[model samples]
Target: MKNLLNSVVGHQAVIDRLTSLVTTNRLPNTLILSGAKSIGKYKTALGLGQNIFCKSKVGASACGVCGSCLRVKNEQHESLQILKSNDGLIKVDQAREVTHFLSKQNNVGEYKVVIIDGAEYMNSQSANALLKTLEEPPENCFIILVSSSLYKLLPTIRSRAQIFRFGSLTTGQLKQIKPVDDWLIELSGANLEIMEKLQDSSNQEIYMKLASSVSQLSESNYDACVKQITSFTKNKQHSLVLIQALQSLIHASYKKSLGMSMQKIDWQEPALERLSALTQSQIMELFTESVKFEYYQKSNFDILLIFESLFLKLISYFNGEAHHASMDRYSYTP
Candidate 1:
């Protein structure tokens, strides 16, 4: 626990609360680990899980060197179950699968732990089904619901759990982190996804390239936009990384709209304005569709057609011709 706290910068209060919960024998049955996505909620939950199952530190803390701790650390623990996602949602059947393992007493452990990384995406049926288990969870089971937006979850499901909000790095604290420029650039874009990955130094070059691509994308050059994004696609190993980059762009633009500072970086005003005009919800709708376009590229969707659609959408928004653009009622409605 001390190691986890010391590793993640800032969020001291959250660390304290989690440490208190684990070390004091006051852990909640259903914990809502609420915070922005990629802000360490899942990682924290896993840390808590490790501490829970660590055999050496038997009483209330984890002994980092124990066999149990090693297993959990390597994600080989039998009792530790993580439901990644199913059918674009954590559906009822998936939740049912959890019940199967949860039904059995921990085979060789004291506790059975489950962490739902994106609980908000659990559809209504699955959520309600999970609520039953949460309402009367097994004696030694721990349920951690990690959410980026708790509001997207049902109040009934929420009421069944103890909601703990995740804390973010203040600008001052973030400025102190290593690779300050890179981290700040990500935070400025309000992208939790890339921020976490940036901590992994190996991805630094790719992260910076993606940042440059996002900053440089505009309608002035459709071919350039395609080349940049396509190049980004070629370079990125995971499709989710690209989506996360776009998500960060959305967040940073929103914060910029609210006048948040980027600390010492000389953030170009025109660049931000151009980014805002190009994305900012109006462009987000199109950009989001672009992901599906990228996804379908493997199965009949033309890459040019997809990027072209995005180019036109960005041009309309950039030229203040969005009102005249033929967007669906739902596209720019929000």
Candidate 2:
């Protein structure tokens, strides 16, 4: 809850740059912290805010135990305002609220920090409202837009902010954060968020079931595989995780086809061996389709239909019935 910069797992370069900027009083008023989900962008934003307001500073970082740091961590700081999505979108009203908050005078620190987590969820109207603020933010006000899909943001909004891209954590960095099983690590693709989800017993069961189903995919079991995978799609979050797991399996198979070594996880061997039969291009297509479906999960599309289409494509590929073509050309009818 504290989200101190010192507690961040990776992105040392970005942190160092931010620290230097903060020390020199040259940090931009508007910043876009763009990265994959759960990679510490929001945490870094809070940590920087804490450092800015910390009463007992420690070498360009927050003391973490100071009263100011505690307030920021607990989201009770008067000067720091965080706006998250309502339902699935950040409405114009929320953007207006941000405008109003920024217009006010700072209460506790020299700077008032506004963090828009999940900034990509801003609809057109909300984005336009927020754009006016980004164009000319109030003096001593800092706004950090944390987004996983930067491209979804309006081009005008993106142009007004200084962007810092956060990359995926390495295995070593992930382990430094917390010890994780090798199989889970491999499945998570070194994503802390996915790894945390996989750690849940129920989620793990779902993942295992998915892996098992995918491993046995064949002409004989095609209908059963579709039914089983679609059953898991009743939960949107579980569906996303399954899609991610599918991508991981395809990625491993792609690597194996190239004579690359895979994680020595015994359980994944069957899936890897089966998927390795796929040509590199075929594997790439499946991976791309999975990524597409993952994005679709955020939309209002029919989840069951989406997974069914995905499994159909996957089974076709496994049966050597899929061809190298743009997935756009492939149409699905209910």
Candidate 3:
């Protein structure tokens, strides 16, 4: 089936806004779609781009059977160019190439659309190189900058684009679009994009390992948590995955303590029930710590040391051994 405008889940308001822009022919040349990772910004941008280029649009929607729409759907459209980092960061040369492409005319479609996925991956040099193009974009050409990290984007580049923030999908929305794995939905906190990745059977095992690690923490088995982290996670990215799993566990527990409904994960619910003894403030504190842990991971700090310290802190909290004194002294800085 074609991934048309309606194929994208949730974000009805974003869809509505895009419909208005397209119908009124007021679509901006530079647009920044921002939101949490795997929350559908990139998909929405791609779908919208197709709809804009489709020769036969049906009242703000694209006619999927049309040749133009089919080509765009299959990523064979000559007028559509997508730029994304292949090696972790969008290099300056990529930006320069996109700038050159945008300066030219539309090849086959009515609009030339350029999608820069992970726009935040643009380093200082790349961002600066793209600034001029954003400032004076070519006619009938639209540039979409998709990013989960809004703060990382250069302010000058952000200022030149019309920004749209895509929010997380609600439980109801998640159920409608992706319902095969409800537990994954709960664990992801309705981040359907991430849930989609977790849908792979292989990923489920990693999540189980992570859940086991959290369960170990509740039992005050600090060594088990460390071993699990080391065993399943090989590097900083892997450590971040473990951290996300832990964050999900903590968040689920927090919701449970508040009498909020949550889908029960067989592996995680046991520890979450035990962790109910944790106060709201303590849960919030750990949530904050997870944020810092992510920052430290991104900063290229020592991976083993970071996970070890985090597991140790989790042990302290679960054992009622954590204190303000220790919280103040805890540092993951390299």
Candidate 4:
């Protein structure tokens, strides 16, 4: 029905399946949609809600001119209930609200609809409450659960629902993105356009300062790791992303030290030489620990202190010939 349903961008496969589900009258009362943030998973659920609420049922198709359609579009439908996540948690009371709403007779529509956003936030009690409802779903009821983290849900609760996986966006599909400074990738929780977004701002000053200090960390030359990471994460706070980028540089340094790769970023030579004195595993351990430390910094344990301590570690790792600085004393957990 041209009625209450709204269109969503990307994921044609998901759209096609949903359309089929509605058209065939085989719609599942419990729908678990998992995907990234800012993506259209919740939007899709809303679309499904509209279709279910549409009054006209011609071979399972919704007619937009029906009273139900109008009510759904205006969000005045008595049988429709929407539950949102609060403080990253969707409580049991909200789920119970759905049950209560659905139990009532439809004043203007044939069925009841519930849209649960961030269903992953449902705590143990909340999920158990939902399990009660899902186990004995009332006739003519539709429940759509949207979540970013599916594994975080209870296995019994998850098993009761039909799972619909929403995949990531394609590069070409990125055109639909609103022109934000940095695009948060819904599935991965990383910023894809962070560096591009940062290229136009005064934020370069942070990188410049970071770059200057990068050299202070090493003896052979701090350029390799320092230049790559600063140049990369300078624009983004993506945790796994920066770690992955840093991993590439570390591998390159290892290759350079073994004289396997002829092409090296000029700044890495001193680092390669100094690191050559250490075993590959030691270097790996150091890099791995630093990656965890970076994640901790990003997750809000204290960014400045982490950065300063990390800076000191880098200096120590690079201090092949340069006299060791007393930067260790400066390290403190903030």
Candidate 2 residue lDDT tens string, 85-178: 9898999999999999999766555788999999999999999998888999988899999999999999999999999999888888878877
Among these predictions, the greatest lDDT belongs to: 2
- Each prediction's RMSD over C-alphas, in Å, is 7.1, 3.9, 3.5, 7.5
Write down the TM-score of every candidate.
0.60, 0.82, 0.83, 0.63
Winner on TM-score (1 vs 3)? 3
lDDT against true structure, model 3? 0.78
- Candidate 1 lDDT, 57-163, residue by residue in tens: 74555666677776776667888988777656887888888877788865554789998879988999888778779999998899999998899899998999999
Question: What C-alpha lDDT, on a 0 to 100 scale, does residue 39 get in candidate 3?
Answer: 64
lDDT (tens digit, per residue) of candidate 4 on 1-334:
4633335668778777887888777988788988866568877776676677665655554576677766765656777788888998888788788778877765553778888888888899888877878988888888888888899889998898999988877644554654432222221123334434335444343433333345345534445434544544443454334444344445555565566734433443454554565556656765676667555656655444455456556555554433245664665433
Cand. 3 TM to true fold: 0.83
- Where is model 3 poorest over a 10-residue stretch in terms of lDDT? 322-331
Residue 80 shift from truth in candidate 1, angstroms? 1.4
Stretches of model 2 off by over 4 angstroms after superposition: 1-3, 55-59, 106-109, 233-235, 295-334
Q: TM-score: which is higher, 2 or 3?
A: 3
Model 3 sits at a Cα RMSD from the real structure of: 3.5
Per-residue alpha-carbon lDDT of candidate 3 for residues 1-334, written as tens digits (9 for 90 to 100)? 4546677778889888987898898999999999987667877887877788777777677777887878777777888888988788999999999988888866554578999999999999999998988998878899999999898899998899999988877777768766656777778777765687577765666677866776667445667666766854566556667667777777888899899877877787767866776789988987887778777777776766766666666666767775535654445655
Cα miss at 324, model 4 (Å)?
Answer: 14
Give the number of the best model, judged by TM-score: 3
What's the residue-level lDDT of 5 in candidate 3?
69
Error of 1 at 328 (Å): 18
